[model samples]
Target: MLQNTLEVSVVKNLDFIESGVHICVVANQVVPNLAPILDRNLKAKRVVLVHTADFLQKAKDLASAYSNYQVKTEFFKIQSAFDIVSLRKDMQRLFNFYAEQKPLINITGGTKIISLTMFEKAKEYELPVYYVNTDDSLSWLVPDVESVYHLEDRVKIKPFLTANGFEVVVNELPSSNKLLRQVLDDLIANIDGYKEAISQLNYYAYTASSSLKSVSLSENVEGLRKLVGLFAETGLMKIENNKLIFKDEDARFFANGGWLEEYLFHQIKQLGSKIPKIQDNLCAVEVCKKTNSVKNEIDNMLLCNNNLYLIECKTKRFSKDQSPEGGVSSAIYKLDTLMRELGGTFARGMIVSIFELSKADYARAKQYNIKIVSLSELKDIKRHLTSWLS
Candidate 1:
């Protein structure tokens, strides 16, 4: 019988899985099943994935990723996962075919009925069955409980998303250079001085992009000369005839606020020094589902302990020149939509911008449970991140 008292804290090394045994799992949420299979100590074996109609493509994608790691995989399908009687018949047939192998069942990914039904079948067949706890520990059920085994495996963005039926089609990681750091830090420290200056730079840079030609700007413009010189020293753009000239689209992008994304990416990585699993910090990440025509590009994102944090960075989008006072609500709407579509349990959505949001938009963001970090918040980003990430 599965008991409520089946909790253990002592880390137990799980070496029970022997060579060449077929490991079975349901494909509802693939990460839980992968906890043990992807652990460093576990050797390659055939993973048999039992999935419903909803997860067919995801199962295929997961199978491919597993093959890359040299683990063999197979699939079983149940037309309706909630159809208990038909599912039991199907599961019985599946078990009989693998009867010789006596596969292990991972009761980690399905509805209560699905897990309960599988557990009943495992008990009947005297097969080993275990559940993955919230802390990534394994709890044995069938064949009786003994200990909870802590999983050494921690998953990154790609595998986690793939397991959840998504794939990263395009990923542009942040740059690891001091140039961006200087520009970002200076702007953060003197936001007041650089506020209008950045907006002016963005205007000309956007003009250059619109015309497909380099636009000239005089550094002699009052309140802009000092900030322009800082950017000039960074070689982000060139100067001619006492004016700044954007050389290409890349420089234009930087002036038009690409640096904000880069800055947030670095600050997120800095959290790694105090926390584990920070290598998945990414910028300009585009993801798509394997079975659909849907796709979204995240400005900056990171994965911490399986929870995805999606952030949208903006410069002139919310400014009065580009949008009306309540325009932030629309961007918040996009973030909220992405969060609901991509964010699983414990996931979060946030908007970090150079401009402060209007009170109405701020209330709307609060209503959607999206976090807001504006110009003032950027200065103390470390503190805010520690709270949010922790």
Candidate 2:
């Protein structure tokens, strides 16, 4: 189930035959699962969607957008998707009505109960049964058709997110350049206690509404003055009346908000470029749920050879005695959950840390299947990243 490119290839092979009705199972995961049926070119005369009451309208609206194909889409609701008995009866009745067009049932969406019931009816009526197995490409369940198809660059970020559950999406990432890498390297080299320094700098700016209003760096705080002194050398800070002032708006924003994220974005984009044939690459993507209640941000993400990589960048020091909700522990949880929701089991997770980690923290990251890139590796960033991603 939920095959992206494999489904498209199967539809392409079935193009020679007369137009037939495609009965697609609709569940909450309609975008990626249903996209292969609707977006691709098929000799589908009409698409009959078997969906639950809540998502019935969404399916209809999605189908209506396909005016170029001139195919009709109808929605038949199942009062309760959990009720297998009623679902079978609806499928039987639809089969009787569209028996002449020879509809093909694609059991890639919906719950297991829906699929099993339809599959049983498919057997009883001796209708064609096909499934797209993302694990092993598209497979024929009933017809026993043995063929493997190769597809590339089929899944895009926007449609996949739109169908999954996101309502608001913004991804406008810039291309990687050597200048970014140089700046990041300079930050690490020129600054002492770089991670803690940036953390304190960020914390100071974060407490203010805007960087135009300067935050004072206490000379008594042991490392705060040194950090401010280093940043001042790079023109990121200005010393005025014994107070540390951000030189420009960019400095204020990055120092307070997403400096680490922006740094890793450029660094990873540069590393990913060295690899050949990456399907997609993006950074600093922000998305929100349907009601715009919860918003999730991805520092960097890339698709390669059917695997989606989710990366998180952190500039804070990890505490050995901190609670589970503490820095490193929470980051591990965030990366793992994002990978599971966005790319399922096949997706990968990584954490690129500007700070060093203890042995226990490294093991914790490993337990969550999160690869780590520590500050020491920044000198040979490309090599370390290549080995990890490869």
Instruction: Give the poorly placed runs of model 1, Cα more than 4 Å off.
Output: 1-12, 19-28, 42-44, 134-137, 142-148, 210-221, 291-295, 317-326, 358-360
331: Cα error in model 1, Å: 1.6
How good is model 2 by TM-score? Answer: 0.72
What clash count does candidate 1 reach? 0
lDDT of 1 by residue, 135-188 (tens): 657787754555776666456777767766678888865667787688779889
The predictions' CA RMSDs to the true structure, in order, are 4.2, 6.2
Top candidate (TM-score): 1
